[model samples]
Target: MAYTKHIPKKRILCRELQFVLVLLLGWLAPHSLCAQRVSIGLYDTCSIQLLRVCPLSAGYKLLLNGKFVEVEKGTELNFSSRGRMLICERAGNEYEPCEHIALVHTDPNAQFELSLLRPQAETRTYDGNLSLFVDFGRIMCLNLVDQEAYIAGVALAEVGAKAKPELYKAQALLIRTYLMGNRAKHLEEGFNLCDQVHCQAYKGSASKYPYIRQATQQTAGMVVVDAEGNLITSVFHANCGGQTASARDVWMTETPYLQSVKDPYCRRSRGANWKKTVSLNDWKRFLQSKGVSTERINNTGYLYRSETREGMYELPGGIAVPFRDLREYFNLKSAWFNVAVDGGEVLLSGRGYGHGIGMCQEGAIRMAEEGKTAAEIINFYFRGARIVKQQ
Candidate 1:
């Protein structure tokens, strides 16, 4: 009785304090619940070999079409398409046509590593769980990862890892916007997006770059949208010479947000200037192939650039050719180029690295270096577009 004298009956917890504690705990919960995992098609080929796939966390389970398959950590797997089926070396298995293998683990935040063994001499590491399957008689690997994590990787891959913090942030926003704008682009192909430039050029995880992660985290769920709250196209390119192109100029589609603008910042950046010399006869022949009359064109005369149009060139004999076509035919670096005759060759002096439509990446980098934030850069490049956070 004496030992328990000082122990008062446990005081009833205050309801206000209990409510406050619950609210604080709710606020402190991880923000990852708001993030989405993107299913990206990777290595679209007939066959692929993963050199070594090891779960970074314990309790990883492999399943094929909801059926568990026996596999251990650090197992090498080869996947080949066999008449719409995937052939795997694990468990001496011959999967049915179009079978999908799912990788899961006990930990909700578990991640795994996939190492490519063939076709690419260099080894690239990829994060997130791997889903191997065959689609339309081809082997496809889908990487299911957090959307913000995907943006970090795509930004570093499309640009580089050594960009300024502000530039990285800008790129992160652009990437995120692009993904949201085209989230269902490849639904027919069984994945949300492709790993190539056709979608967003996502090579692998950018976890090594702290700045990329920071940029992506800071701009989480942010997307460029028009005034009506629709996601903007969010296009970008390597450089734009001195003037960015309008969507109407490049792709013949007039979009309100993709208006042309002068950009002096990219003129001094990398990929600003390029030179390619093709034989004047070859040039004429190529134009003639496009139904243009090259009879009046000579090897030593000036080829007139379009006066009204931004990237169109007026050839002799009334042939108006878009530089986009020429760029593709001659493998030129960009559409912002001028043609001149020099030593029996057509000297194509180009002043950009890409289509010059949408955000000029070099210009944006320069702006970021000069203390422009992601919102400022987005506003400067994308007319009538505003940054909006998705729910």
Candidate 2:
């Protein structure tokens, strides 16, 4: 599947290179899906329509389940066995016979779409001619195995994984969610029979593909929870500005750390994306103003392992909170975490993106350049997570 597009390295009039990185994600079909056949309720049994089984209505189509029924448009569908298969089609469309349908949800051989986009972007709306989403490609490359090309996918699934532990409580929530959703013995057998992430993608349970096997191996027991001490099934975004909110608070509930951000990485990323990196002269002014040593600046533009965001404040517990979110959401207050850097240009030193988490995409690319598999790459970041054969 297609992912991101690299900007051409054309030499500008100056050596200061500037260009946007576009990120596009492609969805892969599930591996080894077990099929099911069941009858659908075209019309409620107690309804007036039930009295007439000669076909529901003039144009009302029936879907056995959610897949395509493949009955031609404006044509009368023929189905004698109501107990054999499902029937599904558009609400107002016609439903043909269930046997005509070959697949559901997606088709790998079908064509895809691409769009142009600018990063360090403003506004989330896309114009479509060629729109692109922005994300950190640095982390996805961290631990690869045998040179797999699923980098974009790694990024897509990972954004939610890395944010947890800090965002929610208890690792069991993730396990229960996945387990509850796919607990059939047939599904489990099918998992052992598949070869990609669309099935069981982790290391131990049923995944056999090396990279996905490896990812599953490493993060064997990680989950996120809410403030009320409940397990959360959904994941949300927009970097809670540092101090993550609980499900109730953010989504307007009282769940513990459910929908929250307990760190300052958001604004730092925002500052980097919104404002140019702090100027060396200005960085010093800001650091000196914050009681940090000017010597921390070194010959570089920023202090080593020091705060560089132009948009945060310390709260009652000495936590850093994002100031930009005061009005839209609750003011954030969380002592976020990150890797410590020594020295470099504020503009150049903090050049790459992301929270400097487990995997570094740019670093992964560099590792890939040096010859590392994505499996090995993922294992590097997720410490106790494992990669086991699910069978």
Candidate 3:
């Protein structure tokens, strides 16, 4: 999978980074924003999706009917479910739910196998304990792991495994901030976060990347906070073209820390420039569908975008439309693009990727290559944001 192109549109980005915390006793609690254990939703319906579970360490055990059964390294347990009961088949015999099957790891540093057995599946390995159960008549895999381990997995999954140590450290801090800020998002769902793009794309484990693991460990329990000591929304993207956009420009609600900034580090990076073309008439029709009247407007000039607004394109009758909306409608890379009239088609020359908010991954990589520290890279992108350790 292309990790750099994991930028979902602005709406999705907003949902991922939104923070709603109250200044009450709940906020002061230790487990409110900082917890060592994270329950990651690995699979929603394990029966439909092929799954294989194995033991990577010597002391791994399967909890069945309140009994701890040692799971061998070579034993492969195939999972299946019916109604509310979960079944585990090994060799040929089928074992019933026994309420729930909990894979326990005795050693904290030892890893285990939580492999996806389907065709073309990324066979991911994981550390920590796993509990397999039937939720809403579907088999669900929940991973109970350490916070730092989860951050390492997320950093490698979002930014790839080969990033520099500084870049990895930067990503690890942002992901830690995001995790703490959105820790209770799925409280009612029996997990802290899901292993999907909607919850920051955690692909099971971090055993494959030692550098990312080290970075997460080095920044353990550290999170970015605003001037008021409140946890800030931690949003990042693949590349920000030449400049980053403000939260108000993308999500309509202004976050003071997410203000627009001039970014030169990612201008020449990968996924920086792109062009998309559509017939002029078709483009005009699309605008007309958005309640715009293009009959009297000149059809030979670049689209008029608002100076105050970052990605709003101004049309005739003073009608303004967000580039985000257009990008979604036309499947474009980003909302930051320039519209021009060609002989037969309207060409959209675009820059950057994702919502162009928070830290730019490509820029962070370049900054790391230039010997900038993780804290420096983070402070450069998020205005007035400081890294702090959770108490």
Quote the lDDT for 161 in model 3.
75
**Residues 1-391, model 3: lDDT tens digits:** 1222332222121221112111101222436554466777775323344578877777788777668888887688887776666778888888756546778775655677767765326667887888766555455677877778888899888888778899989888888888877766665555566776667788867877777898778998788899999888888888888788898877799898999888889889878888899788877788788888878778664464332226678776678777877877788888888888867688888888877888888989899999999999999999999899876
Each model's lDDT comes to: 0.69, 0.26, 0.74
Between candidates 1 and 2, name the one with more favorable lDDT: 1
Q: Residues 103-141, candidate 1: write the lDDT tens digits.
A: 655433566666666544344556666676544444457
Clashing pairs in 3: none
Model 3, C-alpha of 220: deviation from truth (Å)? 1.1
Per-candidate TM vs. native?
0.82, 0.27, 0.87
Show where candidate 1 strays beyond 4 Å: 1-34, 45-51, 69-98, 106-109, 298-301, 304-309, 316-318
lDDT of 2 by residue, 124-225 (tens): 110001111111211000011111112112232333333222111111223323332333312211111111223222221111223433443344333332
- TM value for model 2: 0.27
TM for candidate 3 is 0.87
Count of clashing residue pairs in every prediction: 0, 59, 0
Candidate ranking under TM-score, highest first, comes to 3, 1, 2
